[model samples]
Target: MIVYATHAGGRYLQLKDSLKEQPEGKRGVYVNLTNRCNCSCTFCLRHMKDMAEESSLWLREEPSVELVKDQLESLPWYYVSEIVFCGFGEPTMRLGDLVELLKYVKDIHPEVKTRLNTNGLSDLEYGRNTAVDFAGGILDTVSISLNASNAERYLALTRAKYGLKSYEAMLTFAEECKKYIANVVLTVVEKVENQEEIDRCKKICEARGLRLRVRTYEDK
Candidate 1:
């Protein structure tokens, strides 16, 4: 099935294709928020694909809460098991809108799982504890990127605008997320050298009462 987002709503484009396209048993939907981001990760698919703008997600601009709600309303209930906030860019860039949309979706389909894949810098970005708002909402899981063990390596990987401090900021966000989100995850990109770093990342997650998720590095 083809999941397309537009001003009117999230719509099924042409459903003649394979349904088992996305892994992770996610027969759900993917929502693209905005193309803006605080970091430009070296491994990011945004640089490798055509989804470099909000417009490419078929949005004239960032969708309003009503617009996104309308899209979610049109979705077939059975085909969706989850609703994911993950475009090529940072979903939290449109933090308020994302939260609003999540509330709207949950009101209609409370059983449908909802998730967010982020760089884990929302605290720094929004200057507040954003996780608290997600506590009892549609959000089920939150995946935060922890690319490297050290600040230098993290800076190198993400090329973040926040400098070396972004690593610490991300860890701090993950720590706070544990108190708010039921499933708070710290993810490290897998590579030869990242094995040891991944171990270190696990330790960090463990200390913060969170889980570690090792992601496969695609050579984009």
Candidate 2:
């Protein structure tokens, strides 16, 4: 499915079915853009989750921008607090489409917040500074995966296509994102790293004037 809602147990509900099962109140709606990524992170959910056929995030085919827009247009806007670009793979892999979709969301529902969950390697993938594309208040928040405090540990975890340079590039992207996006955050999964590692990561984020989020590993 192109659009789905995530629940407490890593459960995913298709947009159409979400109306029935979705809890009353605002929740995040995730948009699945593609199943391609530039990194093979050791702790990626794609390697762990056993998704069902119907509710799977693995898209049979990448949906066009128009298709994604239509899907968004059909969503229950009142129930949505945030529209997130995330899925089994990195959302920025389809950077152009993602920006367009973000624009579409702002055009129709300016009150709704929009965010991107990315590995922050878009610059390396596109061979240019991609953070500028997020200007114009189209995106409200950008959550980047800052998996490790150092380059060596980062390369070991992410196995990014950009080699050892990936970690620095990601930090550069985060620094650039601060200029465009209003809320810039870096994240690391819990349990994977010990207290010292987490503390180091916090320091890294603090040094960059960014917030650090410790995401819990969801096994469901």
Candidate 3:
């Protein structure tokens, strides 16, 4: 699906189905731009879930920026609280398109919030400080996967294409985001790591002045 909403059980559903299932409240609308990622995280749902064809976030091909905008335009404004750039893969894999879409959303609906869910390796992917592209308040929140407390453990879990240094680069990207994005969140999945490890992650965030979010196992 190019644009969708999530339901219970971590189910990906069309906006129409989502509304039909639960018709009343505002919810975050997710945009799936591509199915390309820099990391192959062991615990990611992309590897674990078996989704029905119609609702799968795994895109057959990357949607054009105009196509994504068309989907965004079709959304029921009253029911949308936020617009998130997230899919089966890393949104930053299409950085230029991603930024343009962010701007498009704000230009169309300045009041609605916007966010990005990322692996935080855009710097390594682009070999530059890519977070600056979000300047001028086009983006509000950036939730980066903080898979482990240290570089080795992180590499073990994510199998990032950039190798062991991917962890540090991710953290650096998160820190750089603090300058441009309003809310910078570093996340660690609950069941994927032990309490000791989670605590260690919290410390890492604390020392770095970043917020740590312990996501529920089923959270997406």
Which candidate has the top score in TM-score?
3
Work out the TM-score per prediction: 0.83, 0.95, 0.96
Off by over 4 Å in 2: 50-55
Worst 10 residues of 1 by lDDT: 6-15
Q: What RMSD, rounded to one decimal, does every model reach?
A: 5.0, 1.5, 1.7
1 or 3: which has the higher TM-score? 3
What would the per-residue lDDT of candidate 1 be over residues 1-220, giving only the tens digit for each residue?
1144211232233212224333223265777776678998877766644445433454456666666666667766666777888865688988888888888778888988888999998888878877787877568889998888789989998999889888998998888777767788888877724567788878877877778888876543
Question: Model 2: per-residue lDDT, tens digit, 107-160?
Answer: 999999999999999999999999999999999999999999999999999999
Sort order, lDDT high to low = 3, 2, 1
| TM-score, prediction 1 | 0.83
Reference-based lDDT, residue 19, model 2: 65
Model 1 residue 137 CA deviation in Å: 3.9
Error of 3 at 193 (Å): 0.4
Highest-lDDT candidate: 3
The digit string of per-residue lDDT tens for model 3 on 1-220 reads 8888987778878889999999899999999888788898888776666542444776777788888888888888899999998987789999999999999999999999999999999999899999899999999999999989999999999999989999999999999999998899999999999999999999999999999999989635
